[model samples]
Target: MTVSSTSPSAQSSATRTQTSAAVSVSSETALPTSETKQAILTQPLFVYNPEYIAFLNKSLATRSPEEILEWALISLPGLVQTTAFGLTGLVILDMINKIRNRRQLAEHPVPLIFIDTLYHFQETLDVAKRASEKYDAPLQVYHPQGHDNVASFESHHGQELWKTDADVYDYVVKVEPGRRAAIENNAQVLITGRRRSQGASRAAIPILEIDSGVTPAVLKLNVLADWDYARVWKYVQENGVPYNVLHDRNYKSIGDWHSTQPTAESEGERDGRWKGEAKTECGLHKDYFKMRANYLAAAKKRKLTESTDFVLVDSEEPSSKKIDS
Candidate 1:
């Protein structure tokens, strides 16, 4: 979390008080202990509590990056460690490596998960390999089902499903696969690479959150939610962390191969991705209700199509029951 010092008089008269006051914005207030956090997250109304956000804000405002990570180490369990093939995630992964090397935490290290949409740049995969080997952390990669590679996927589902009908694509390719990973791993919590200064969607994102989706049974921890992009880059450089080299090409945010691009614009960071689309997330981190609604809608459509196929087949063959009648 990013800790800042600001007083009412600092803006108006810094010379008047001769004293500096710092506010505690560490990400430690949500859950003091990992076990306690696990228990509280499963409880109802954990997401809606006003104090929860306040605590997150305070923690991020006052704590250092290392301190925030320590809080995560002790306060998050059942953690589904994740990476986005981004610089920030790589930095966090490096820190996580240090934590695991301490021997005690290594015994119960957080499991790593990567959402392999098969649309990633080759460099991304290479970096993933390097990070895994260096940390010796078991990394699990989740890909869209029923296909071995992107070529087969595109051939069957069409090349533009993500563009023409994004929601269905998101469900089948991203959300469903991610949910499967969580369920299979019995993940009661998830870790992500989200930061607040990114935009309005994440301006108030907490360091720790109770993910009340599908089931109010999982927690989501954003360890570096308060770190800015500058800090992330600095950490990666200092640690010599392995990261996607595409960031150098102006791809501030990277995703599928076809969807990702290089942007030279000054204001936009993720704009180079999914060009001209308003979609930031691919539904993995979206609300559970929204994901369920999309999934149900797609399922209903599939059922209708199946029913039509059955009727057509019957009409062509002539039903034995009708003949008997």
Candidate 2:
């Protein structure tokens, strides 16, 4: 979807009647049960003790990304990769392809999960399709609940929702969809593309850590955590990995079209994302409980407003009818 030029406040204040219903339905029906949550928490496929995880991080620190991937493939259960088709993710995808070829495997061992925010650049979309096809990896794509594309999303939530309420927008477009993908895939470990060089919240990220944001904590393997932007670019060039074309235009890190921009040569890789904002990582990598709470609160307020308006209209209709009669 193309980015709209209208300012968020200036955008039409369309009532979100359909969006409220959708949110209510999803909150009621899509959330996992207590038993299911317990199962996901207690019945982990691998040991996730803090001490053991620390040991794994130290052990994998000096190893190559490929080596890390190989170890994870054999050891980590329910492993999957989440990507936005950035340079780092593409490098990992290429490495996975090489690993699969060497092992003579028919299918890539680890599948991929992509959250389509419906506001991504056209270049990002093209690369996702191309990379998945090239690697023969299983890609499961998820979107915001009730809406399939940008037009429907804007029609219900109003145009430029991110400008109006960023937290609510992030929850709907990225956080919720990512959580759903994880649950549906039964993912216990996620291969991520985060790196220390990205700065901000990622400056001191370890090679692996337990992600407690979502229900039933899952392991996140930053296979490229120790790698720098130069190294990542070198690997991408040597391996000819498919990546977003925006990189050619100075867009170092890519997200939704509205929030992403091109970084200067001296800037950090992710400087292009959410430029001028204090934000770094998207809500997908943040606390799921907090984001959900905020989104639910917003939805409740909207519902109440809609209900109030309905009552007022209903009460006035009879008087107007009597006057007419």
Candidate 3:
């Protein structure tokens, strides 16, 4: 049985400031690559707790990505796959299709949740839409409240909030909406597309993580945590997965056009994201409470300049007309 994480708002393990709730990672022991057939039948360990780590070390490490995901489907009732339709995400989406078609999965084996920041490149939107239609995924899309368009988003958060304050931008566009999606859907597990080879921030990404960083700390299972970029691309190409078009333009990791850029041939997959900055993971994979606090602080600062506290009344317009409204 799992206990409440350190913070009530725990969403990811990164949120816990306290050390007790944190499910620590150890590179000391490398898990086996493949498991025997007998292990597949065993019920996965602790769908809600950090004990999932023991399951990974003992059973899941030896399984294929497809098998691991299958076990997750059976183990996690509130399982939802969050994707940006990147190569890794698309690859898993393809795997889900294969599993559902071959095996007798329930009507909705796993639902797909997406955060539409409303500032994504046109190609990114097209790719997401295409993947949804192609796979017949039970898709749930969440966007920034009251700012579904660029103009409204800028008006409220200031023009290009990401440029001014990346934390606030991330909270408004990704973290808050992600938490809202989890709450609205009653989702307990978030199947992420993260891989260990993504770089430093993800260097220690485990297959199962108890993320107690949002309300009701979410369980995150990175199916492709062991796979590298080359392997991920291999699976996508071999499976004919529908991926984002921007990847064709040397853009390895694509987010909003303003924040993301094409990577040099020598860089890693995520190097393209939050380019020129030290940022690696988006707010989606980070601690939710800290992100919220940071965003609130940043927004308060912006209010000083952006707040319409003393707008000059248009004296040219009729005073009576303005007053009545």
Candidate 4:
């Protein structure tokens, strides 16, 4: 669901309507009807309500990331930012700090949500730790189910889950945990570091969008949607933000250590991710509900089959159980 184009003042009023019975907006004038106020409140989107998407796309078209974030903090209640602490994520983290510092706000408006897949490189975990301390942003870290480290995670899910099934890999490690974090924290809106220039499925990301990607879709905003890698890198460098040390070694977009690889400039920004596969997104930006259902089904099948399969005492010595049984 989306709103139609309206003046900034009128849109600002629409934001107030979401919270109160009064149809109060920016200017003194009121909108025509009580029904108009109801429509604004009833929309599926949490953040995109007051301003039409077109209005946001055009008005915020030239605004800096800081400007966009400022509007977001004011407009959306229960806002949270999720990241993997990649270069773009670091850039936004710095912007959040700068915006809050300028407003003289005692507390950060949006808390950070960092999902620990338990398969992340040690460097990625280090970056998350350093970013939380550096920005002093209220940080919320969510790990996969009950696992905190690789050895435990591997024991729960078979070794190299990604190589076995990328869908299950994503559902367990990213999609489920991300959704859980949002709900657990009461996150009404999720701001991300996605940029249109990231290429592939991410090439068409919008400035503000309803993430129909997940069931019970959440409102998402790509504050840096207009930026490219160069812009993000420049911001990170100038601000001296904490970033994963692996980026210096050519890991462009870090996920698990197994999936990521170094990329030449010619290979494009996200080519190093899920390398050699046609896949671009790691199911986080896709339909996660569909993937979860499939993963569970496959796991059930595996469990039933494993119970019947006889283990070999040695490579040359099979169990005495009948092969047919």
Best-matching candidate per lDDT: 2
- Local accuracy of candidate 2 as per-residue lDDT tens digits, 1-325: 0112233421122422332222222212332334554465467244345554555576677677887777666555567787888999899889888877877776676667778899988888888888888888767777776566778888778899899889989888887777766665567788899999998889998988878665333688899998999999989888788888888999889999989999889998988888899988788789989988888798788762321111222232221110000
Q: Estimate the overall C-alpha local distance difference test score of candidate 2.
A: 0.72
Could you give candidate 4's per-residue lDDT for residues 78-103 as a string of tens digits?
56788999988888888878866776
Q: Residue-wise lDDT of candidate 3 within 1-325, one digit each (tens)?
A: 2444333332345533222221232223222222321243243432343443544434666777887776666544467777777888998888888877776443446667778888789998888888877877656776775555788777676687777778878877887777766665446678888888987778887887777675343577788999999998888888778888888899998888887899889988888877778887778877787987786677576553423111222334211110000
Clash count, candidate 1 = 9
Candidate 2 wrongly placed segments (more than 4 Å): 1-47, 215-217, 304-325
Error in Å for residue 36 of model 2? 21
Whole-model Cα lDDT of every candidate shown, in order: 0.62, 0.72, 0.67, 0.69
**253: Cα error in model 2, Å:** 0.4
Tens digits of per-residue lDDT for model 1 on 20-62? Answer: 1222223333423456645754664312233333445465556
Clash pairs detected, candidate 4: 13-25
How many clashes (backbone N, Cα, C below 3 Å) per candidate? 9, 0, 13, 1
- Consecutive 10-residue window with the lowest summed lDDT within model 3: 316-325
The better candidate by TM-score, 2 or 3, is 2
